[model samples]
Target: MMEFRMKRISRKFSSVLAVISIIIISVMIFSYGCVKKEEKEITIGAVLSLTGKGAKYGEAIRRGIELALEEVNAEPNRIAKIKVVYEDSLSEPQKAVSAFNKLIEIDKVSVVIGPVLSNEVLACAPIANLKKVVILNTSAGTEDLRKAGDYVFRNRESAIPQAIKIAELCRTTIGIEKMSIIYSNSPNGKDYQNAFMKRFEELGGKILQIENYKDGETDFRTQLLKIKESHPQGVYLAGLVTELAYILKQSKELNFKTSFFASAGIEGSKLFEIAGDSAEGVIFGSPAFDPASNEPLIRNFVMKYRQRYNQDPDFFTANAYDALKLIAISIDKAGYSSEGVKNTLYSIKDYPGVGGTTTFDSDGEVIKPIRIKIIKGDQFVSFEKQEK
Candidate 1:
């Protein structure tokens, strides 16, 4: 009887061990399957002017995105690995459309960022909508983009803020009653110039003259001379940075001392580099200011940017970083689905960004502060912050 009892006890212990082993194996297989199933990858497209007049701005934006990606990946709890594929628009509208199609149809990117120039953004915005992909503008600030479609979102403030701020600054600070507007005969230039003209006129300021130039025109002597004869208090330039620099140089040579003001087209350091001392004392309005911003994340970004690129971060780059951050936040908040991302972006309100706090209004316009800066000693110094 004792031997039989011993045999039974041994069998029972062996059976319990076998059951525990089977449970451990099953748990291991289930955990492995879940891990394999949960790996998600996201692809984003960056369509920028990487080879034309806007190349410098595009490169700066790319660098900013690179920096942001580094920081994002370094985090301990990232949801997915993001892959950014770049397409060069060359600052041409048709090329921009082609790139957009490729990104959507071939690369199959879930979302797209940029086409830094307003013309390019306008061209591609429709394609993005037709394809049901989100097109977030990092640098382009054309007012018409707001009405392009529901699929488009601008990270930077629109031309309206710039127009209103410039008008107020000219009226209050400079006491300028008369202004002359010179802009390139392009969609971007005309749009900005019109908005500024409207606001300036609304402030009881007289439009002394309005002149137009082609995009690649090297000689602005005729236009500058015409504006000089008008003798306006200020000459507002709405065009490419290269053209603006040429205008300034030529104006100075002609001994024209009228105060010069520009939209964000003149906010780049390369603009000053190209124009030399001519850029000094020139007032420009931007959707963002680098030094005036007090956010810690922005400060760190500036430091890292300078360290890596040996250049000061401009509004273009800062805006690109903010766009990426907005995408990341949306992904974190709503998961990695296209609809979720779009909904999150549309719902974003008062999100603190490097450029400033961004709140997307009904028209997909980012409501933020616009800042006016004066070029002093080869640097942009803040003159005033315009609250929106």
Candidate 2:
């Protein structure tokens, strides 16, 4: 009878152990299912000039976007997997419109990043506003882009700040009292010209001469000769990089020794490659792009960009990178809806970006510090106020 009692007690203990095991297994399965269900996905679209005239800008933007997407995906606590679909705008206005439509209609993307040039953005902005979609323009810095509507936001500041800064640097740092302006007869060039002239005159500088040339014009001997005859202390050239390079080469041919100031348009390698020796000592205002910045965010981005592209990141790439980061941040805060993203964008402030800390202003424009860089020797260096 004692042996029977011992066996019965052992059986009861076994039954309790099995019931606990089932309960633990049930809880484990439920937790696993919950985790699987929590995984989310989002799709963003990019409409860039992937080919034709604006290909270089598009390529930089694409690289930045891809880098941001990778970094976001690798975050251990990230709830959503982000993806970007790209459409080539060919740097044409109509093509940009079509690309924008395709991204919204076909890909069903509520947010898009791109159409890098001003004209492309202008072309696509109306449609975006109509559809109530959100657009984060990476590098379109034209003055009129600020009026593109509430749904459109740009990562880079408008050309006005660079113009003002360039003028200030020329007058105060370079000690220039008189300057000449040569600009392209395009919207981009016209905007820079107006802004610079207004700011320079306001700062007590004399505008000795103003000249304009049509876009794609290779020969600038006439304009350069006219500018040289003005006897100005400096010259500000505002136009595309290729044109700027040719103008520089021709200015050199004319033995013009005046200081040279360029628009942010001259931010690429093409200017140096084509102008060669003429590019030395040329100063321009760009969104700050110092890879040696103390901010770890900037340092890491610089390192990753260099590692992936095997080249130094420029202001354009930095702007695109900031745009992507802002978009991701908006998505996290506002969910995957277009209206949510648009609302969050306006509220973003002090966003630490590789370009600079960005704060979106009331007009959907970005406000950030612009750096004055001089091409010293073979590289661009930030111009210090104390440096002679």
Give all candidates' CA lDDT scores.
0.83, 0.86
TM-score of 1: 0.90
Q: Which pairs of residues collide in model 2?
A: none
Worst lDDT run of 10 residues, candidate 2, spans 379-388
Can you write out model 2's per-residue Cα lDDT over 116-183, one digit (the tens) per residue?
88888998899999999999997876889989998899988888888888998888766889999999
Tens digit of lDDT per residue, candidate 1, span 1-388? Answer: 9999999999999999999999999999999976764565678899988998889889988987888877766666576777789999988889989998999899888688898888898888777778788888888767788798888888888776786788778876668999999987877788779988988888889999999998778788899898899999898888878889889988988999989998778777667666789888888788764754567878787888889888778888888888888888888888866677788998988887887888898777888887788788888888653232
Model 1 alpha-carbon miss at residue 349, Å: 0.9
Model 2: runs farther than 4 Å from truth? 1-39, 385-388
RMSD of 1: 3.1
Which sections of candidate 1 miss by over 4 Å? 1-39, 385-388
lDDT over C-alpha atoms for residue 282 of model 1: 85
Clashing pairs in 1: none
* TM per candidate: 0.90, 0.89
